[model samples]
Target: MAFDGTCVACLVHELKEQLLNGRIAKIAQPETDELLLTIKSTSGQKRLCISASASLPLIYLTDSNKPSPMTAPNFCMLLRKHISNGRIVDIYQPKLERIIHFTIEHLDELGDLCKKDLIVEIMGKHSNIIFCNENGMIIDSIKHVSAQMSSVREVLPGRDYFVPDTMEKSDPLSVSESDFIELLIKRNMTLAKSLYTSFTGVSPVAAEEICTLSGIDSYLSPKELSGDTFKHLYNQFTIYFSAVKEGRFSPAIYYDGKEPKEFSALPLTHFGGYTRKEFSSISEVLETYYASKNTITRIRQKSADLRHIVQTALDRNKKKYDLQLKQLKDTENRDKYKVYGELLHTYGYNLEPGAKKLEALNYYTNEMITIPLDHTKTPQENAQRYFDKYNKQKRTFEALSKLIQETQDDITYLESISNALDIALTEDDLAEIKEELINAGYMRRKFTKKKIKIKNKPLHYISSDGFHMYVGKNNLQNDELTFHFAVGNDWWFHAKGTPGSHVVVKTEGQELPDRTFEEAGRLAAYYSKARGSEKVEIDYIEKKHVKKPNGGKPGFVVYYTNYSLMIDSDISQIQELS
Candidate 1:
């Protein structure tokens, strides 16, 4: 997960734009380093995600993603005690320095209105989630930055705090063209490198985008820029700043084919062809991608043994078939030899039947051999016995042929089912697929006769355009959605060639708008194990082509001629169903 400071900036901007005046409805710390803030915005309730993890620290507004632990972590409990029901008074970013401050107003122990400042510094290793009193006295923090850790300032209790200094750099959002050029020249680097490194809060990618818009090479030396060139660059930078203020988010994922790719946008060229997606914010990207990945991982963890069981059965059967095939081949040689023996006995008198000094001609290979058989038996009797031997050998071949065919068929069937599992999306879908394995004797059935209590169907989301989308939780639910619930015109989607749940978008005979398709694709991609991947391939097709074989595993199906899209594994755009 690329939980960079840029992602944190995007989240802060989103909260200020879409959820500025929203009240803090609920707060929960589901993990040691994570917080889920449920806010009641004018549009609807939204969940904002914040984390101060040593591995990954970022703050983003997420629509749908799995919470970390079922039990609350200690940090979460501490946060709930200090900040519950705290109304957000203000949300501000500190000059694009990868930090966001939320001024929350609440009643103190004496029931008087008190204000607390929650500062989120998203500076990678320096990231901290701090809670302070109105006087800037540190109350508690997700992480404590002691004096020993940093020369700047301590984040311990009772310390008077202030935001970190940006040293000598001018704020990119407000600096004059001459100042910008002066800072760039002092850096003595490429235009892309200079702007990102010199400016307070200017990401390398965003800086390069400015150069791109101005028709200037990002690799050009900053010292080579003329006065007019500097002015042109500044104007382009301003355009982007204004665009961000207007909420124009270009959500994207960079990858090399099937694997996720990561790079700092500071060197824009390194982030090649980062396809802009249909998402509105970074949180949407995190939610969809991570949630899908979580589901896939969970199912894989749960069904690890079932997969092993089926594979073991397959290996055992394959070996049996190989041995039987070899035996059949050897029997053919034995039968032919027996026939040769009988022929030699019957035709011995015509050749050199019992004469040790004479060799008889071999009928099959034209080799000469001395025939020693019953002396009283005529050549005619021996010939009749050879014919009988030939007939018996042919019968054995016929018997073994049927057995070999059955074993090969079994191998083919089991392999097909395993391939279907690779594309399963949800645990329920896996459950359905597992049933098929059990029924075929590849696995043992545990819930043979117990009545299964059906939970409510997976959460449903209605798009802004009013299209209904249904997400399946497991294979049994997938079967229900595709076969019994969905209409013919409904669109079906799944993570291409991976285990994931089926996502169905009901058009209701209504033609799907393009946004709806992208949104649905994002959901499908997000719900698979590949969700955090740079690009998760999604398979989309009309509901009509999907079919479950009789007694097939749950969520297993056969379909062809589907459209595929490479999408980022984030589903933050669609509002989750309550």
Candidate 2:
């Protein structure tokens, strides 16, 4: 998680094995702080990406290539001039620090072999890629840091290159058992903090891992630890670093449920109960972990406005719906008013002129009732006034009932769109939703300059029984998939009484296996608003039985008869097709 000195140690070990003696074939700078190097090694051609970005510094071997700028940056040109055809003599890490030094032997402009050091520092804010001569004098850097920007050290050309020791942390590889104990006992910090602060490369997570290995509480004060506890901690710490020295790295990513929590270059026994995905290389681990994280981050950024739009509309509709319900409730007295009018109409002839109130027997309830009246108006006029109130309330109830239903429909539509946004994995998926929103009049159509043809399609899956299943991503896809893509014999599934994707399993002119039907139901439930619920009720029927209403909203359908199943919304076993 820290991407600290230990990770750098692992990377250097890997680079030394894969890239040592490799000839630099080509170098390209695809971004302001990124470089892609193509190298010819004894094994094969390898592409190495190194980034000095302040936000997300990374170094990994990748098979994919990035598009370079039309004009190379000065740093890119400089590296090309110096090390274009250089041979990598050695790759090493300095004192277990978060830095990598690549020693390159190349011919200078004078046609004489010269050596240069290409240093990549992966420190958080102070990260940089620097090229220096054999004398350790900086030639140039990807990012120029001066005394003005940082009082700690300057990274300008011709400055003597050296790793900063501002933190005064001891190198873990050199710290003796006695030194480690003395250092921790003297510190007033917590156990976790003392480890990270006193030793290089020990992150908080790594510190906690040591505690777990020693069977000790990380919150306990180091000074308060007993003699046996101290010995256990030291033993565990030594064992952990011993693997790094011997290159016994077991790269893996820890997961909390389905979410990636952290990755390490060594086994994280502290995460024994959690899910662990082991990788062959740390580069593979970083690439897989970050790529998934980046996709989610990018999609969230792209769908932020859509989420806001949907949520706002949802709130408005809910308010309107509640107000309508209240108005509908107000009409409850309409029947009483009607009864009063009827009683007055029948008993009006017995009423005295100028009476303030009328006392009459309510025949319906068989009870005496007192009804207020207008003294100046005749009994007939009073009865007519009561009749008008009844009529107005009755009319209000009818209109409100219809409006309430419409408002509820709008709320449901918005929730479905929000769920679609959550399921969206690509920009194309978002485009489909945006189009749906624009068509629904919930958002103004933008005057976009670039017209990316919408090719968003339904998610296709193969059930455990080998039946092809199609799940709609949004309402538009749902309608098209059910009405056009599916055949009459195909089985359809949906989450009962909830907004969800329509799932259709192609029967292939044969009866569907029970397992296929269950998988389709699971897909329907997983893609719907009821996802993750203990048991989601799913309705399944033949495609022919699911009829779309005339002039209905997208994906709205009617079905009088359908089989139902309560099942978990787990589709991890289903095979997905691109």
lDDT of each: 0.70, 0.89
Which 10 consecutive positions of candidate 1 have the poorest summed lDDT?
Answer: 261-270
Per-residue accuracy of model 2 over 390-424 as CA lDDT, tens digit each: 99999999999889988888888788888889888
Q: What lDDT score goes with residue 83 in model 1?
A: 65
**What lDDT tens digits, residue by residue, belong to model 1 across residues 105-133?**
87778898888888887666677888888
| Model 1, global lDDT | 0.70
Candidate 1: residue 173 Cα off by (Å) = 4.0
Over 4 Å off, model 2: 1-4, 12-59, 65-169, 187-197, 204-263, 267-280
